[model samples]
Target: MADLELTGAEVLGPEGLHRDGLSFRDGVIVAANGGRRVDLSGYLVLPGIVDLHGDGFERHLAPRRGAMKQLDEGLVAAEAELAANGITTAVLAQFISWEGGLRGFDFAAQVFEAIRDTAPGLVTDLRAQLRFETHLLDFYNELPALLREWHVSYVVFNDHLPHERLAAGRQPRRLVGQALKAGRSPEAHYALMQALHAQNGEVPGALKRLCMELKAAGIRMGSHDDHSAAARADWRTRGVDVAEFPETMAAAEAAHAAGDAVIMGAPNVVRGGSHNGNLSALDLISMGMCDALASDYHYPSPRRAALMLVASGVLDLPAAWRLVSAGPAAVLGLHDRGELTPGQRADLVVLDAETKRVAATFVAGRTSYLSGAIASRFIG
Candidate 1:
């Protein structure tokens, strides 16, 4: 890539925002200016967003049931959306759950393979995260091998089974639709749920063993939708140090107390609360409980959420922006590409200062996205 000196924009540095020129060459930020200068007087340049978890790519991969089969093309399209939203590094959370169809094992494997194949050609840094349903006991023994084979390093344990309904021998809500989507009869699906529920006693032991194996393999682990302090503590004990969207304040607090990274959905912050009536992400953030903000299922929410926090006085610009950038990079143990500093990867987003919309995004010093009047500055 050609070296370029970006000048006149308000650059967000590690200390704070300043009117300084930023220069990069060979995909790395540099201290000395050596390239052509691009004046960006009306823009604000900040570290590119590092989205720790998101499933919004699902719509791109499969817009509708059986709508798109070219997984590689879908991934490329997804990268465009991510770059437009100012995300440089994104973790696509694919599910390996009993809930079949797109979230099933076969589809997830295809998605992972597609990501691996397509990422090298794409500018956005796309990574895979397997969201494995904990109740899939039969699949536990094979998970470590499967993850390694798929080149997935991040795993999040999820338990979405309606245990209370199952224990009461009642059918879960939307059983018929769920079964149809899974390509199974309603009776078979219900039976499967009951069977999975029955194996609850074996789940904890299985999870412990599985966590140990994954830990040995250097895989990062997290727990999803944790509901209580005890549950969060239990997962932490099992070496799952990241908590994804803990459902209760107690769980979030427990994760924070134990020094685990707590990832809350950025959409929750933008919308002012959880859509399902769970504990509010804004509340957690205000109390210093949140470690980072993820895009979740909305690619644009991370940027919007950080700005909203600043507008509402919950945090200053730097602190709020960190939730979407440096904070997330830290959570994922990424030592690079979250800050606009010398020697860091040249990953940054330029926003219109007046409207705060993404005008351009650069990943590894290459233009991943360019739009509006800013396109002229880069091209000229």
Candidate 2:
């Protein structure tokens, strides 16, 4: 890699933003100023985003109901989008759920394998995270082996079944659509839901055992949409430390109190509230309960959300931006690449100071996305 010194920009450092030039060589930041200088007077150079959880790549992988057959190409295209949005390290959240078709085990395996195969050639650091449905007791025994095979180190447990409705013997909303999507008849799907709900008593034991096994394997575990303190406590007891999108303030507070990493959807912050009337991420952030903001289902939201927080006076630039950068890196247990400090990976994004739009992105000192007037600055 070429040695370069980016000068004349408001470079974000470990403490805050400064006018000091940033230099990097051989894919890592350096303390010495030995590279060719590039003037970036009107830009704000910041740490590249570390996205802990996001499923926005699903559309790129399967644009129109299996429209894209080559999954590797889809991944490459997804990486382009991620780079455009200023993400350097992204965890693509793929589901292994009872829902078949796009979210089935088979589809998830394909996505994971494609990511593993395509990542080496891509500039963006792409990783796979398995969103496992907790009610899939049949797969619990083999899930650890499956995760190893898929090369997935992060796992989030979720249960989307409407247990109250099932216990009431009432059909869930959109049962027929869900059944068709799963390639099962409405009657069969309904029966399946009932059976899954009936075994709820046995789930805790199975889940605890699974969590123990996964913990022993050194895999990171998290719970999704946690709704109560008790629920958070139970997961923590099972060695699940990360809390992804807790649905209530109590749940978030519980996670915070326990020193667990609390991840909120970046879209929730950008929108000022949850789309489904759950807990407000902004509220949690204001209370200092949220540790990081993830892209969730929108790649651009992480950047927009952090900037919005600063614009709204919720936090200063460094504090708000940390939710997307260093905070997420910590959640993922990554010791490098979150800050522009020497010895760290040279992962960064340059944004037009006026519009706050991404002008360029770099990962490992390699240009991943460079456009607009910034391209000329580099070329000239």
Per-residue lDDT of 236 in model 2: 99
Model 1 misplaced regions, further than 4 Å: none
**What are the C-alpha RMSDs, in order, of all predicted structures?**
0.8, 0.9
- Expressed as tens digits, the lDDT of each residue in 64-103 for candidate 1 is 6763778999999999999999999999999999999888
How many residue pairs clash in model 2?
Answer: 0
User: What overall lDDT goes with each candidate model?
Assistant: 0.93, 0.93
